[model samples]
Target: MIRFICCLILLSISTLVSAEEKLLHADFRHRPPEMIVENNRAAGPLKDVLDEAADVIGYKIEWRIAPFARSLKGLKNGKVDLVPRVIKTSQREKFIDFLGPIGHRQKDIVFLVRKGKEKTINDYHDLYKFEIGIKRDTAYFTKFDADQALHKILLLDDRNMSSMFAAHRFDVMVVLDKDSIESAFKQKDFTDYAYADYKHKQNIGIFYGLSKLSANTKVNAELSRILLDMSQSGRVAQIYQNYKLEAPLRLF
Candidate 1:
């Protein structure tokens, strides 16, 4: 009886130690080769850093994978605890706590059109005459849609939106320069196409979306320390490099 009790006590202590560790939930919606789903697994630069960050912090991660809308809902309802990459916006501040930035300030939108229509998009002023594809409800799209000067907007989901661009269904599509380049590269096409400037420059910050708890402030401070240490020691760069991503943009 004494030996059995000792074994039980040790097991209980082990469980207690594990329960004290934190769990971070991470999610992303972009498709491959940037954010690819393969053999029931997600892989890319974002996932690489997230996995490393969780390991570094001694925390386990419960990953959520879905379309953009579903992932946003997960973050809002507290169904998930973290989002690997999100562009910080004033409206989103109410829901998520952020970590270090993973991408940079994308200054201009690259306009992709059918092969022969390159000359049509000369500048932002030319946008008024063309039908442009924009992802509805995204921070950048929302800001762009609200401006009275830019009219004739056509909204679509990112996947369908990209398909339309490739099919020549639209004259021009406004997308982030990096994302446009990434998409073309993923399709194994390296050719450049028509593009023009979108005056508004956005600062994209990739962060962990912590659940709102009474202990949130304390949680953020702790997470920040882990991220800062990762940044200073080049752990962040190493993780991104492993997945073939550029070193993360420093916002904080």
Candidate 2:
């Protein structure tokens, strides 16, 4: 009877361990003065958020530094267990489930033109007045294509797009707000360009993206519970503070 009881306890422990299998992966990018890492370890606000979430859930994490396009492919292929951030859309719902949204909607695309020139456009009607720079295959442009107001929008690769704007091939260009701001600060010549804030307004919530491979309902529920608990206990705030990011806008 003693041996049988001991075996039962061991089996229960094994089950618990198996349930908490190592199942997290993250991507890396340069966000400057914010998140930077030498190897796979994190040293920024993004890393702090991911680490805190992992600690709360009792899960392990693996890191992969790759281009944005490659990282998306990795997530879709299950080569990546988690994507640190992404916009949740209906199209993506078919292949993955979003765990929770932890970040704000900060990724808005902006329309840029020469600083002193009256080249900025506001509405869709204004957009048709000039050639607009947009990325190929991005959802932003996909929406633009669907909109009747932007029928004259021009799609260009980054090099040709930005160069055309510099050369005045297009009177205006639409670029991500964050990227445009960062680029203006980094590039001296681009200083002459200014982005009008109202052309494309998209509120995108950044979520802890999960692949179908890690879509077990039980694990997802546990993760959600952990996140909510962290939010209530101020652990999430602590992590944000550690990285000098503004504390979460809302705990809920």
Query: Candidate 2 has what TM-score?
Result: 0.71
**Candidate 2 at residue 17, lDDT?**
90
Q: Write the per-residue lDDT of candidate 1 for residues 1-252, one digit (tens) a residue.
A: 999999999999999988886676667665544466666677886677666766766777677667666666777787766766666666777876776654454444466665566677676677788777766555564556566776545554566665666666666777654563456445645343555543445555556566453232355666666766777777877876777767756655
Off by over 4 Å in 1: 1-22, 31-34, 102-107, 141-145, 148-156, 177-203, 211-218
Best candidate according to lDDT: 1
| TM-score per candidate, chains pooled | 0.74, 0.71
TM-score (C-alpha) between model 1 and the true structure: 0.74
**Against the hidden true structure, what lDDT does model 1 obtain?**
0.63
Q: Which residue pairs does candidate 1 place in steric collision?
A: 99-207
In candidate 2, the residue pairs with backbone N, CA or C atoms under 3 Å apart (3 or more residues apart, or in different chains) clash, namely none
User: Model 2 over residues 44-83: C-alpha lDDT tens digits?
Assistant: 6656667667766676667777545666676688777676
Residue-level error in angstroms, candidate 2, position 105:
3.7
Sliding window of 10 residues with minimal summed lDDT for model 1? 210-219
